[model samples]
Target chain A: MATGVTATAGTTRGRSRLRAALRVTAAVFGAYAFAWGIAAFGSALGALAGLAPAEAVTAASLLALLVLPVAALWAFAVPRAVMGWVLLGGGGALMTGVACAVRMALP
Target chain B: MSRVGGPNRGTPRKGKLISPALRAAMLWPHTWAGVTLGGLLMLVFFMGSLAVFAQEIDRWMMPATRVEAAGVPISLDHLSLDRAVRPVVERLAAGRAVRDWYVQLPEPRRPVMALRVRTDQGNAGGMATVDGTLLPPVGTLGASSFFYPLHYSLHLRAGFVGYWIVSFASVAMLVGLISGVIIHARIFKDFFTFRSWGQVRRSLLDLHNLTGVLVLPFHLMITVTGIVIILPIVLPAGVQTLYGGDIDRFYTDALGGYERPRTGIPAPLAPLDPMVAEARRLWGGGEPAVIFVHNAGDAASYVRINRDTGDRISLDVEPVYFDGVTGALLQHRRPGPMVATHRVLSGLHFAAFEHWPLRWLYFLFGLSGCVLIGTGMLHWMEKRRVAHGVRPGVGWRTVAAATCGTTTGLLIATLAMMLANRLLPAAVPSRELVEVAVFFLSWIGAGLHAGVRTVGNPPWSGQCTAVAGLAAACVLLNWITTGEHPVRALAGGDWAILGVDGVLALTALASWRVARRLAHRPMRMVAPTNAEVSDHA
Candidate 1:
């Protein structure tokens, strides 16, 4: 019985590995798009106010919260979409970088 | 030991079975190793996690101690070496029992001239004004700061015993983590798959394995770094052998050179302002946090400025020692690569340089590490239950009960301590004792509840309830004691206290939901009759 279970589990693993690869690729692409969107929005906010670079970046973080709902909706509508995972990962990274850069450059 | 090809070797009983000898050999070590040290590990991890925010917690707990005045650069012109040295030296000489004297100048957000006078009888240190007026001792119970010291050096036996115990636990944790990872080969596949409804035993095993795998990196890093943080203590024999047993020389070479000793004869000292100015200039404009003046009135009276820029984890600043009379730069200790690396590692482990975002990340990772350990313990219990063929024996049950009690119970106990800090009278003698009382009492309560309730229902639900209840108590206690509503505190820009309260509230809500789910879980009845077991087999 244990041997049969092991054999079945091995086959399932091989199938899942392929699926996981596809999922990862989608996650990465979605992350990039989300990060790019955030960076662009932050730059726009920096231009709008005469605030220091850091302040502008902080303001941009506030704006990024709005995209959370969109991300949530995306997660709901397409539960396993590679795009949603990517967006979350990429957006977080982008915002962190922008915030750090602004902090160093501004004051 | 049983021989190969023995009847018991290949036998498949109703439930998993091993010979008495095999069971004793395998189960005894596993059980004893876990049971003896599990409570200690939970304490270390939990306290260390809280210690990550020691400074912020200090700030929140002792609001009255908050330094309102910003530090001003000490002017070189106004510095009178004779003036500063005469007062401190005279005081020390009069006491005649003084071992060491440390003078600390003002810093931003904690502007107070501090002096530490070390005597044969422990050490006495407190804040003072620039003009040398000693302030009343601050009485607020610093929960975060208290936990910080307690974590690495369990507030017992002058920190030596604590260090050894913590070091041993760290090594054990590392072993457990590696062994656990190896045993569960399908680690990644089970990530994020927590099925709460299934065979109760199988579901628990799955949940434990999944959570452990997900947070394995955090557990590994924390365990390894915790050992590294105390590496000097654990590996002192090696250092002793290599450095010819000159611990002082080893420290100086490994860390930085200790300031040259002073001539006992009185002499003028250099003003601190120039030293502070030079430090700021070198560090590119950050506030000099601590000013250490050595050899107070002698020719060797040198001032070293430690800048607190809050930029990097490495607190290394150029040390400028001067001739007391001439104010000439004597020696500057710029750390080499090894020393700088050590400082950086210490800073990272302590989270001293973290801001809000990074601190939150540490908190999340710490919580995940806790969950990882917890799940691993639970999984071990489930596996034992399945293998034992009967309900686990008294010893196994005790360990299972303790695992639930200590991990989740300590969290609640910490919350209870925080609440005690506020409700207990500020003027209460031995306030620390009061805090400890609350901590232990809450822990004992959880332990008793776990021991009693575990027989009827799954232990996880009771553990969850304990955590939720404690967390809720913390939030409510804060409101009750401080009279600072969460919204009002947030509005007032007192986010440190507010954030802690809010996070505790969220933790309670989440745990409560988990508890509710676990409470409804159906109980399993294992067959007591040997005939029934044979039939199943």
Candidate 2:
């Protein structure tokens, strides 16, 4: 009985540590990637809407900075660490792809 | 203190906006981030506070610049920019073909105009009085050049690695602040509560919360604007996407900057006073702070004059460009709304406006940020001391040492550098580098000492005493070398030097008192109560 309890506790500790590390990684890199995507996509959309290229970039960069910290904190707030990775990382990739397509489509 | 009516009593988690689970999750990041990056934040805050008075410190360090122009307005109209400044620019070129040149007009704080020339050989610069008489090299980077850069850049300019690191820490700081606000949802209830005479742990926590809550707005604004100033470089996705990775082009478009390439055909440069007058008229009355003549002696040369931004809370200088040969106005572009907003944010962070009261408030609030971070770390160690028992572990000791090294050790290093500046001979090769070496070497020594002594306890008392000694020594050395004591400085109307001396004296007194208290106070290891234990958990 003692051995079983010890094994369970050790497993729980290990699993929790891994989850914590994942959350940190997702918070830092995932949030940054998401911010970058927002900047790129927002800039492209603004330019398409008739704003000057520089103005679009400046406004989009400001928006990205405002979103970055909230996204970083959200990674920690979520129930499952994997959810953070999927939402931030996957969504960032999708937005960036669309932004690139828009850039290529521009005259 | 009725549980029914009191805020945060009994149902601590009830009616709170932030859920318990979310708060718990945030706690981890806040604690770890503050712990890991708190030292760097301390350096940034302390150096930034000092940088508020960077020009004054420059006057203190380089005594040659303490010119008597306190109330005398710099009348550039009467002073010939061509005769007074052009000769200095040409002299700085040293017979080498001048590529470009710029002159920073003297203000009240800095009475000596600064001029720099880029030549085929290299870049050379010098300081000259408003009347055009060149002064000897001060042979020191001083505060404006060294401390200000250290605050933002950490002196690591290669590929802007320092900017990236500072930005990362700033983001972490933002995270910590948001989490702290959530954790202390009832902060408003204890807005004015400060029980400094109570238990050390409780008092430290109170001070931390007090400063954190009170100075939150300033901290938030300062940190955000600091990041905004370098946003394009640190987060360049938009720039890369829109401008094809050319940051300069984005800046040119966003900031309304104008430039032209050299034609390689030589032409005699036109006089500069008219250009300055024209720029003033274009702006409807503003001082010409900086005049840059690009592609000097070329047919395509153009002069850019930036208006002084001291009177406004916007970093935008409204640069006016003119043909260098004809002195005719060429370009005067204005920024769009978004760009204008960016300039205002940058201005708030730069605090270059001529408002002494606001500048001092900025300095005080910046120091409060240092206090906030320092007290947070101290609170953590105090709470952990009981858990670690009589003999603390390596991890605990490491934090204690780092706290000491960053707080008092940083002060020691700064004071040591100031002392070295005064002591080093004028003719010593690389005198500035020698002072910088003194700063780093002393800081390392203090850090090593903390590491060794922290086995039993942090070497705070010793380091504090050393800080007091070094600060006092710097003041004394300044008086001895420059013969400009605080009293003499006052009589001479050199308020800049007087202010530096006054701050140094206060630092000495404050450190001495703190050291005495630390020496007398016994480290009591109180048994951890249920509340304390659970707080850490």
Candidate 3:
């Protein structure tokens, strides 16, 4: 009975550790992806709004830098790790896709 | 910024901006990021601080460059660049055909003109006095080539891996800073709080918070600007979307740089003085700082002159390109508004202006960053010691070793390298590499010592003593070898040596005092109870 209890405890500890690792991974890379999406979308949108390509890129990049830290901090503030991942990582992908589409649609 | 009711479920505490759960969550990234990357941050900050005086340090190390006329800026109008400078470039090319060459004009801080030539054989560089007499190679990479590059690149050039790592740490630092401010309940109160006579833990926390809150703006500005300087390289999403990911093309467009392919037909280059005069005229009177002759000895050669940026807060030189044969203005390009804004931001970080007070503030604020990171790690170690009881765990020991290695160990390595520069034979082949090797080897040695001795407090006092002694030795050796003692240096008007030696002396004194204090008060570990020990077993 004691052995079984200890084994369960060990498994629980391992699971929590794995969850923590996943959260950290999401916080770092997911936030990075989100920032990338911001940069891409902002630049493409700026270009479509008749700004020069270089100007749009510079302005977008500056804005992206501001977004990165907040996104990273927000990743941890969210209650569920999976929610953070889905929102950051998934939102990043969707935005990046839209950016690429917009670029393709450009004259 | 405060979130309202959520799944946190914690009782709302009075006067707290953030929920307890949010604060706790922020603490994880803050603590872990500081622990893991604090060593690298310390290195970057310290190296950057040193890089602020890179030119001065270069003068200290390369004594041959301690020109008596250092403070006097050489006039481009008075010097015949084609007559005096061209022969030096030709000599550097030797029998090989000249590809291209550039000359960095003598400034007040650096009295010698630095010339670099790219020949068909390879590349060669030598310094010349204001009168264009070629001096022998300084032989050492010195601060500009080594420490300044190490600040941003970590000397890792292959695939920009160093830049990526540094940028990642910078982002982590930004995260740490913002999260830190969010979590700190009384940042304003903490700004005025430093209880140095209190317990080490409290004092470390106080110092950490004090430095963090005090220089927070500088830390943020420096980090953001540093990142902005290399944004295209680190985050290429915007570049990829707009410019098809061609960083070179992006820079050419963004910075208004001009270049053209070289023609094989040989052509005699026109006088560079005319080009400098034309560039200055085009800029409505600005000093020509660097003159670049591209495609040398070719029909397609063009001369580009960059205006001095010392008087302004923009890194833009307002480069004016001239035809090599005709010396006629080819392209005088100016950056657009957004690019100009980027240059201004970059200039803030570069701090290449002539304000000594601002330069010293940059240095001090930079060192404050080091103090912040150092105290943060110290606070962590102390906090963990209280929790973990008498004997430190493996995790604690590792952090302790790294803290020692990056803090005092870094100082030891830098001082030892400077000492090596003084002691190494002047004619030693690859003396620069030897100095660098000394730096790395000493750093490794210090790390190993810390690792081995981490079982008992990580040898902080001993390492401090070593730093004190090594720094003193460096100053002494410089005097003994170069015959330029601080007093003599001042008398002879060599402010560079005087400044370097004076800092070294101060370092020695401060380190010695710290060593004594640390030795007197060894870190106290909480004693584990017998019951607790058995419970662990």
Candidate 4:
């Protein structure tokens, strides 16, 4: 009985460690995706707001870069890493998708 | 682990972690990451600091690139662009299917007429006088070509590899900066405290903290901006998605690509003087720094005048266009507000518009960043030695040697490259390549020397002695080869050349003093091997 309990504990520990590793990996991808997606969306939004292509590109790109470090630090230090992915990664992808669609629709 | 004479300096008397356990976890990562990549950071910082003076170095390196009599700012007052450059255009047009020709109008900083011809075959170029008398090649790549790029690309093979390595180091730097702030408990206290004459370990830590904090804002800005500048290369996903892998197309769309299509029909080239005069009028007394003629000797040929941006913090690249034949004003694209903001950020990073005093301040801050990284490296080794109970392994020892070589070896390599430029035969085929070869070899040699000598304490004094010798050699080499010795330069009022030699002599003196001081300092106790333990007794 004791041996079986010990085996179960070991398995649980191993599984938890793997989950932690996966979460961290997700966080990495999320942080970068969020950073890139914001720049894309920002540029499109600027273009939509009647800015010149050059102006839009420059303004959006710089603003996005400023946000990147903050996003990176926050991703690593979040209470639950999954929440960071939901808020930043998912939101970023959605924003970029909408922006791309809007850009395509415009002249 | 007592405070007065603790065996391990890092060991706390109370041994309490800073408030939150999660925040405390950041400390270890910060220290280890900085240690692991500190050498690369040191190289970046050290090379970058020198690159601030790249233009001055260029002037020193090419002693023959004369502009005018001393104290007189050279201008293209007497020269007409069409009359003076007709022969150059005619000669170049004789070649097969030329695409573009770049004619750099003389500026006060670099008062020489330079032209580069881009043909269907490839690019070919030479320096020239206002009358198109071809000047001989300098045979040395100036700091603009070498150290400035080395600061960013590390002279690695041309590919994504160099970009990746630099970007990775930059990321490491970011982490180091962030974590360093947290781990440095009592940050304000560290800002005020520098225990230089105290225990060696304490002094090392204090110096590291002091320099790191002194230039914290600069360090942060340089790192963040560096990553952003190389963003497309590092993070290509956004660009790839938007432009379908066409970088040029993306730039065209974003930068308002103003390229005129080539008309194959040939025609006589028009005079550039009128166009330049018109451009100056448009710029309101500012001269055009560079003039570009697209589709040279063709009906479609157009002149683009890039405005001088020395006074403005922004690098104003928006050129005013003119019809080459009619000299009619074509297109002038004014930058928008966002574009203006982008210019400010990039301008701040490059500091091209900054004057001498600001440039000197940037140089000092950059050097402090180098010192900060160097101290961090030493502290890491010291910390490791105190924590571990055995002699440092081969890997650790190799790093120690590299730490010595990179700091001093880099200086020697740079000086050697310059010396080789003066000493090497200028007529030798690919003379530029030969000089570069000498530079790499000297750098590698320094790394090897450090690897061997840094067995216990790093041989700081010995490397400083080498530095002093090499620096002295630099001054001597310039005097022997250029015939414009520091003394002669001073007599002639050629401060540019004299400044380089003066700085070299001062550096040599500084190194000698450092060697003397380092030689007398007590060596730190390494994890005692049999030899070290016996020596200790």
**Would you list the clashing residue pairs of candidate 2?**
none
The residue-by-residue lDDT of candidate 2 on A32-100, one tens digit each, is 989999999999998888898988998999999999998998888776778888999888788888888
TM-score per candidate, chains pooled: 0.67, 0.95, 0.95, 0.86
Against the native chain B, each candidate's TM-score is: 0.78, 0.96, 0.95, 0.88
Q: Runs in model 1 with CA error above 4 Å?
A: A1-107, B1-36, B66-123, B127-136, B157-159, B284-286, B294-302, B315-327, B448-470, B514-519, B526-537
Model 4 over residues B1-537: C-alpha lDDT tens digits? 011111122333355544333344344335555666788888888878878788678777876665444466645576677777656755655666677888776655555666778888877666666557666887878887888888888878577687778877776677677767765767788789888887666688888888878789998987877776666556654454455556677565554446678688787667788888887877777667778888877888888888777777676666888887677888876667765665666667677773878878788888888888888888767655654444777766877787887888888788888888878887899988888898899989888888778777667898889889888888898888777788788888776677778888988999999999999977665553433222100
- Chain A, candidate 3, TM-score of 0.88
Q: Please identify which of the two predictions, 1 or 2, would achieve the higher lDDT against the true structure.
A: 2
Quantify all predictions' global Cα lDDT against the true fold: 0.57, 0.87, 0.86, 0.71
lDDT by residue (B228-290, candidate 1, tens digit) is: 555545434223323344555656555445567757776765565565576666667765555
Q: Write the per-residue lDDT of candidate 2 for residues B1-537, one digit (tens) a residue.
A: 011111211233668567655555666677778889999999998999999999899988888888887658876865688888998887778799999999999998888899999998989998998888888888889988888899899999999999999999999989988888876767787668799999887888899999999999999999999999999999998898889989999999998789989999999899989889889999999888899999999999999999999999999999999999999999999898888999999999999999999999999999999999999899878877865666889988999999999999999999999999999999999888998899899999999999999965799899999999999998999999999899998898788888999999999999999999999998785776656655631
TM-score (C-alpha) between model 4 and the true structure: 0.86
Clashing pairs in 1: A31-A86, A31-A87
Interface RMSD of each: 21.1, 10.0, 8.0, 11.8
Candidate DockQ values, in order, are: 0.01, 0.39, 0.42, 0.19
> Which of the CAPRI classes, incorrect, acceptable, medium or high, describes model 1?
incorrect
| Rank order (by lDDT, best first) | 2, 3, 4, 1
Candidate 3 CAPRI level: acceptable
